[model samples]
Target: MYIVNEGPNNAPTRGTLKRRDIDDNTGGTPIIGIPNLHIDEGELMQGGQWITYILHSDGISQLRLVRIDGQEQQTLYCAPANTHIANMQLSYNGQNVVFNQYPNDGGKPSLYLLSLASGSLQLLLHPQNDLAYTPTTWLDNTHILLTSFIPNSGAPRNDLYALDIIQGSNQHDTDLQKLFSQNWSCGSFDVSYDTTKLYVANCDASNGLSATGPTTISVQPSMGGTPQPIAHLNQAVTMLRAVSPTMLLLMVENGSGDTSQNGLWRMNTDGTGLTRLTDDTTGGQSLCPYSQYAWSNVTQDSKLFALQETDPHSADRKLYYGSLDMGTLTPFADIADGTDMRLVGWTLY
Candidate 1:
């Protein structure tokens, strides 16, 4: 796993990137240090040799590609002022990249695509009829899954769509196909490793932007089919990741005013054998009140993960790494004590 120890007060996002072996109880080795870097907003390439990310500073964002060793860095594209780039995703083949860009006007966000080989950037999709489009996942090398909804409005109606990049590589016009339109907001969703089934966590949008009550986990054919509800949870599920064709990992909100239910969980895709792997209330080295987490990789068999926790009052951060079924967690060392260290994605290698 790799972590970014953000710089001090002056340049918080500028700092050192380090890699660690979870199996070893030692501190990580430094990889590279970059200024104005948004480590979390980047994707590690397939071969783990390169990373494509956006750098935001002084109100401007730049799409950059850099080797892991901090050599041969290339600024692929620089956005105009007032443009915020986010939710970047590299294609499966590592040939193309897609991301969402929101303008300063707070209107609908636009999606853009960049070709790494040719360095050709194109306007992929622009919202129509006041809908904001966000790139969710790459179903294949050519097809990208997207979710559309209104921004900032109460209970924005959500729907799923797929964009055929090969057919829509031209400017501003996209070949889109609607996949689901039930109006129930999908808080989180993922496709099976084989890309045959889609797992979605549906939330009630009648009250507000967040889920009001129980959230339902459903499975359906990725192309299009009737969704089957497999499990329903009382807590709000902030994240849902399909770890394998038959297993899933979830991060549910601990809203019961306690740490008993605060942590990660695993469950079978068939909705059976649901169990909490990390029980902060009763386990060793509690990873309670964590703000974010990421699996080692997106592969179906991935079970290793890393999570980040921040001290709200002191504003300090910590990182922890462990594999599935291990209730106990060991604190990662060598992380600059007072700096803000963030858990970035794991390397494929």
Candidate 2:
């Protein structure tokens, strides 16, 4: 499972990697022992075979690769001293990856791509030191959309753009056309299946991705323009994925120890049909959800949904999964408390 902590002040860590097998619907336990190395950030490739991840716990910041089942693991790339890999995204085909290099010298994050098969890594685009162009999602097999903040830009201040790797060539882009802009900072956003619309996760002015304030779900043209609000929540959002063109899967932070309010949530793009997928009703008592799996790799059609939950204010944590056929959430595995083991992607079989 590819994941990140929605917890406040927590950086992505691999220390929490606790694996559980998908229920075969047979009467068997799902817990699998943990691994040794800590993974900072990672993603299961589209092929569902390879796992592309970054390691930063040690002195050296590195990018590595391996089979999802602990096979052929090796370091793919490592950052030089004073530089750390920012956001890394795997291509849909699993043959390539794009990441941003953050330099301690205060330069803008430079985007680069590495071809796994040939091991050819090259710098793609580098913006001025002041701007940050972070990858959000792939628009298709070849195009990716990145978001940047434009403070004081009248009305909507955020801007979006499509970066075409194949056709972009060696030239850098500072003049790419803007897709659209929103009045608030969009913590997380995704594209529609048809590739014509955008689903945005905008947070309150002060909270940002910290989940301290309110969050609003909205939609707009893919090419960029004003965003139309669809749904507004009282709390901040930690994860947002466009499961279908009209459906969104999100996680909101209700509060510490507030089991009735926090957990996984699903809703239609229009903000109607809002439903709480995880709740205290199943646990028989209030259970706090400190983290969640963010990548939308697995869904209801996969037959099970997993949420990491725990008792409030302590290190007690467990892996919880809901069966689509049965429509209920059940504890699956025991995990070390306080460790950040976000879903990096899962191999169903």
Candidate 3:
């Protein structure tokens, strides 16, 4: 099953969620999850004047893009051949799209790029041995920061590498520069707007592949520099986004107790001034960290969008848009029935 939501303010009015069996011989019956929510404004466009995302069928993966209103676009922008497309990010201008493609059968993965204007598809990296996943962010229009995992080693872990897309083609191998090697899995990372520093989440305390201690979020300069720990959380920090050089958005699970009830937190880049945004104490369901949330630029301030699962009665998910104000939160749209809507990626046009 796959779904796509426009954003907090631009949701669809009436659509159907169909679930089809992929292996069925006769093409089985389609199960509808929920109705689609409508948006008053049209779809997003190429320029940095609107916002939009691409929802794929895997239910947990998606690609982000910007498109014009009533464009009647198809799902071929970043389609991975014989693989599942996950973890996508768009360039600042929304012209280039980068994502990770994992083969369905099993093998080392590669990074892919899509030219929205030219409709050209290219593979950026095809590792000889290790498997790559979870591309952090675009350092520039031609370079991307990513993590690769080499299996069977004593300590299987993710290492940071910079992939230069302009150096090679899909038929040939590209150049990959090893930036830093770590003992733990690299969760999420973001590059500064000026491309000077990088903020990353990792379990850097232990020696094994799976570090047992609380995850540490840190920032390092693009040039050689020590990684300074920004915040130490009791639980594992799964996802993070840098709203600016001074602010960060994070999703944290409880370290001591229940892991299902993850909470949303915002804090300064240096780890001071921590603020809790969402509380899941009562009955609020946890949002999908990868596919449910995004931050956008609106003038000087930033806006947040997510598929909020308010309560059990709220049809599983609704598109929500809110301001980045400290104490106040306002909803721009309430999608009554966007159940199958999985956020792939977002672009500010």
Regions more than 4 Å wrong, model 1: 1-13, 36-40, 152-157, 170-175, 182-186, 209-213, 256-259, 280-303, 311-314, 333-339
Pick by lDDT: 1 or 2, better one: 1
Give candidate 2 regions above 4 Å deviation: 2-18, 24-37, 105-107, 149-159, 169-173, 183-187, 206-216, 225-238, 254-260, 280-297, 300-302, 309-312, 323-327
Compute the lDDT of residue 5 as modeled in candidate 3: 41
| 1 versus 3: better lDDT goes to | 1
CA displacement after TM-score superposition, residue 41 of candidate 2 (Å): 0.9
Q: Which pairs of residues clash in candidate 1, taking residues 3 or more apart in a chain or in different chains?
A: none
- TM-score for predicted model 3 compared with the true structure: 0.65
TM-score of every model?
0.82, 0.74, 0.65
Residues 1-349 of candidate 1 have per-residue lDDT tens digits of: 3546465443566745566655454456666666765454656676567867666665677878877767798888887788778778788778998988788777667888999999888888866566677777787788888777778775555688888887764434235788887454535777887788888887654345444436789999998899999999876565687766677877665434334565678889999988876644422222211111223333224656555655544545567766666645556853436665655566644
Off by over 4 Å in 3: 1-68, 72-86, 100-104, 150-157, 170-174, 182-187, 204-213, 255-262, 282-300, 303-315, 327-338, 343-349
Error of 1 at 158 (Å): 2.3
Q: Write the per-residue lDDT of candidate 2 for residues 1-349, one digit (tens) a residue.
A: 5333323223433233234556554422212222333456767665456666776654467888766556677889989899988678776666778888888665667788888889998887767534567676677677777766432332333567788888654436654556765443434677777777888787654433323446778888877677899988876565677765566777666433233565667778789987777654333222112111223334535555565555555655555667534538776555455544354544554
Q: How many backbone clashes does candidate 2 have?
A: 13
